[model samples]
Target: MGRKLEENLNFGETESLGIAMEKEDDEIYGIKADEMKKEKRKKKKIKGEEENQNLDFSESKKKKKKKLEESQTIEIPEKKKKKRSKAEGSSEEGNGALEILEEKEKKKKKKKGSGDGNSLENGEQKHGKEREEFEANGAVVSGNDTKESRYAALTSFVESGLPDEVLECCKNFRRPSPIQSHAWPFLLDGRDFIGIAATGSGKTLAFGVPALMHILRKENRKTSKRAVPLCLVLSPTRELAQQIADVLCDAGKPCGLKSVCLYGGTSKGPQISALKSGVDIVIGTPGRLKDLIEMGICCLKEVSFVVLDEADRMLDMGFEQEVRSILSQTSSARQMVMFSATWPLAVHQLAQEFMDPNPVKVVVGSEDLAANHDVMQIVEVLEDRARNDRLVALLEKYHNSQRNRVLVFVLYKKEAARVETMLQKKGWKVVSVHGDKAQHDRTKALSLFKEGKCPLMIATDVASRGLDIPDVEVVINYSFPLTAEDYVHRIGRTGRAGKKGVAHTFFMQENKGLAGELVNVLREAGQIVPASLMKFGTHVKKKESKLYGAHFKEIAADAPKSTKITFNNSDDED
Candidate 1:
């Protein structure tokens, strides 16, 4: 029994030991499997890093290549630009005129070719031809079909196509002035017209005869008892208005057309009475006319013809709003006529607004700012205080006899009165006209000046524009006016009606801003510019505005307005 028990215990011990060993082997196998899997994972990571490095290197090479190509492209254009600029410089220095002539010849050839749909080129050729013709005529005309619309300049009053009565009125005029000759046909054709000529160029008669003809042709024309003005003329100054009224009255008298003049600083009572009494034509300044129109004493509803004489001056005098209001009261289909000494941008804007889109524009001289070529412009640099002695000397030299008219212009109303006093003290027969004077006094002064009774007249810029005193042998500028344009007008006071006259201008240091423009004007008119004036650089500064100063942009009236843009926060976030 003891031996059997010992054997069984031994077998159980063996089996138990076998089971423990099996568990140990299994643990060892699991640890080896984990090590192999970790090795495989490490190998995969190394391969991924190597591939990523290769891709980075290739991408870097591509970027470098692109940069080099871009640099080459930029350099090529730079080199070409340098060559082109050098060529241009050489051409400008050597053969610019030859190039221009060759280009013109090419254009002429192109113009002779078949009429294609190239309207731009054709229009340019037409403009060139018109410019040539205008140069030949000693005038410059620009508009659509100006050549076709323009009539041959009338050499004789008989060819004026005017009524015998009207012709008789112009019998004293040796022949039509340049402006009258060119503008008569267009006006008589009942087309909208813009006449640009110097002052005293017979612009009054140019429009007057046509206006009279227009009125006479109206079958329903009212009689003197109930006559409403069929024509309206607007002037800038009261003097100009009165002058235009006088001319129209004389011309329309043979036709039994009564006219009335309306202006401020005078008795509106007479003007109102004349309106009530019935008139065929009404000539007035903007302010008084606007007052009369608003007062319901005047009616322009029947007016079929309108004239804006000295339109630029009217605008310059801040009469644009009043002029616009007056024109608004006239007939919409009215034949609009604008006669101005200058074709300024303001005048152009006004024409665009009121006149016909394709009106016949006749420029008797250059469209640029120009003085009357008949006037001899003499500029003298002197101290402001020295002007008195210089003026006395000039008067002695040019106005010693004082039989012919001598107009003296000053910068200010105070200066006009002071100069008049000085001249009076010097025992000179001088009368003064300025804004300070009463309308009656001014009228009397002008009458005396025109009649050559007081041949020496001291005045301000108010008399610079559109004052026609025949035989004004000399004009002396006691001081430069506020603008170069006014300087031109001041000199233009003399040398009118195809007569030679002299202008003596005194320039001071304060007027250096206009020195360049004055030089250009002198060169254009074939006058000599002083060396002292040329010391001021020939740079024309842009015109600054009174309201906006340097910030003012001279944008076109018809330029497109800027658009506003907005960004949404949500769009940026997206």
Candidate 2:
């Protein structure tokens, strides 16, 4: 009888393992449709780019064109690839994203490079047969009236009655974005999900609120170094990770959850000590994190919840190898979730390889990061390098209101410094963040800007995606982004908390080839198109309102409107 009972126990364990495997397989299934947009070509290549033709991609004609491009969209659950927009430079662009930073700098390399003329942009959503009808007439299926959406109620998840002391940390409004609406539910339930939304859409909260929910709901007994981290959120950049960490720390504080931020650029000794002591959640960039793990100061064995925020950026920045290495450190049964503003090749591939089946895909704003819907994107054509002058004029025009808190972007670090200096000379109190600045300086600059002490922040792509300075009145791109993806995130910096903001870009002559990509980006972000694009050799749709509908309306106006949020200080009065 003892031997028979032992045999029964052994069989039961094997059966349980099989059941778990089956459950995982069942939850992780997906089928990707065609993904690539047609290689943007001259009107000569495609007969139908009717200069100003309002081509709604939700149309069949465009679908037919897309099917001809690459044509393979296999919905995989665990593969990762390089996102194409990581595009580049007259100054020896290393190829896509323009310049692949050499482990060392090539300071001597300088060229008035005319143009490589490659076009990059976000691909439209995979449409089913029903999409064929919508596209034929050039109108998309109206969004399912959110009046019926599961998230119509705002006060449920957003906690109220919070003390002013906690709210004073970040001044967060008590509301969640649409992506947060769905993500919070699954995350709170300990379920993993792939969040497909635009940057600045509050995806941080989707992952953050959920993580906080777990922190709040779960009983937090005093934990030791041996106690595993409850959550591990990985971002690609120090700025982004730190930004997320700051928000999480503020939000979590009210609920009694402690979060430690880890990233490169500053000191690591502090991170080591913090991890050694223990933390409820550890948010960080991959490079610094890999070092901590290698040094044995950070341990992932105890982490059960993992989030890859801006997974596409991680893969694009060549952190896939590092991502895989880190994931390997986590427990096999851990829950993994990835959030990206754009679901490019790299993003989809990572999902296929790292994600389990049935990972709910929440594509907010068409996997374009709500770029086309919420942003008032404008592409102003500039004549050659006169971009600096054009930028000044644009700033002067937009700065007519003293309440404007703005972010200005340039392509190169040197240019960012120059712009900041020029603006400062012109009596604008501006701060800049770039790879060239000491990490501590960068953090201070960001902190100052967030505190409303610095109204205008000059930045390169490094400050583009992850920094969370909200309610910025304007975003000026003195240099056009290499791809539409960057454009999306850049403009997304403004128009946050549901407030209408303006995005003015200097589209140089060399960037004319990216016209399609630019239009697609703006149409997605809900920005109005300038007629200048048509005369300068590009096809675009007739102007229509996407999110706030033209004329700079408040995005957060729907909220019980609050006092004007500005970063300007006493010096601005001078």
Q: Give the number of the best model, judged by TM-score.
A: 1
Supply candidate 1's per-residue lDDT for 187: 81
Model 1 Cα lDDT, one tens digit per residue, 165-213: 8776787878888888887877887878877777777888989999999
Count clashing residue pairs per candidate: 0, 43
lDDT (C-alpha) at residue 445 in model 1? 95
* Structural similarity to truth (TM-score) of each candidate: 0.73, 0.62
Model 2 accuracy (lDDT, Cα): 0.62
Weakest 10 consecutive residues, lDDT, candidate 1?
A: 112-121
* lDDT, residue 65, model 1: 53
In candidate 2, stretches whose alpha carbon ends up further than 4 angstroms from where it belongs are 1-155, 158-176, 213-228, 254-256, 368-375, 400-403, 425-427, 523-532, 535-574
